[model samples]
Target: MKTYHGSCHCGAVKFRIVSPEITSGVRCNCSICQRKGALMTPHIYSPDDLVIESGEDQLSVYQFGTGVAKHYFCKVCGIYPFHQTMRKAGYYRVNVGCLEGVEPLQLQVEVFDGKRL
Candidate 1:
């Protein structure tokens, strides 16, 4: 497992998560995801794997559809760092682009048919 550190574009929010080295990610065609255009971790992570190092107060939450999933972003920069998924309780999916030293565009990506939900 590896610990990845991430932050918002404006550096207002910072966080870390432990996961297997990321080699790929998922892209959702859901309305919100299609609009945001972020690549997310292919696997779900338990809350224990994630730690907000700083700027927790700088974060904001957004929810839609069934309002089960909670999307979190940096209020200052409007960069999405991670989100809690409705698919699995207390589990999260991190934005691959937000991770330091990671090339999100270079990873192999699979499209998720979230639009049908």
Candidate 2:
């Protein structure tokens, strides 16, 4: 597994995720995701595979609907770097934009039927 680095707009809330260089992305139609315009790869990883480099207290979480998924954002910049979905507990949906040295269009994106969920 290759490791990639990512951070929020303000350089706070940095993290790293281990995954392959090529990834499958996910596009969700959920209300918050749509508003945030999140285009992400569903690189689900165990908590051990993810490292929160800094600003642990600066992270904030939001939940809606069944309040199952925990959407985590940087409190300073309010950027949703990653989130935990109820459908896949103990794993996180890492935002593709957050990953360094990655081009958005290069990823193979799959539309998630979040609206029907």
Q: In lDDT terms, which candidate is top?
A: 1
Q: List the residue pairs that clash in candidate 1.
A: none
Over the stretch 1-117, how does candidate 1's per-residue lDDT look in tens digits? Answer: 999999999998988999999999999999889999999999899989989999999999999889999999899989999999877857999999999978997999999998777
Candidates' C-alpha lDDT: 0.92, 0.84
How does residue 23 of candidate 1 score in lDDT? 96
* RMSD list, candidates in order: 0.9, 1.3
Instruction: Identify the leading candidate in terms of TM-score.
Output: 1
Against the hidden reference, what TM-scores do the models get?
0.95, 0.91
Native-to-model Cα distance after best TM-score fit, residue 111 in candidate 2, in Å: 0.6
Off by over 4 Å in 2: none
For candidate 2, write residues 1-117 as lDDT tens digits: 798999888988999988877467889997887888888776677898878999889999988888888899999998889988778876787888888987778878888878877
Q: After aligning candidate 1 to the native by TM-score, how far in Å is the CA of 105 from where it should be?
A: 1.6
Instruction: Report lDDT (Cα) of residue 63, candidate 1.
Output: 93
Supply the TM-score for candidate 1.
Answer: 0.95
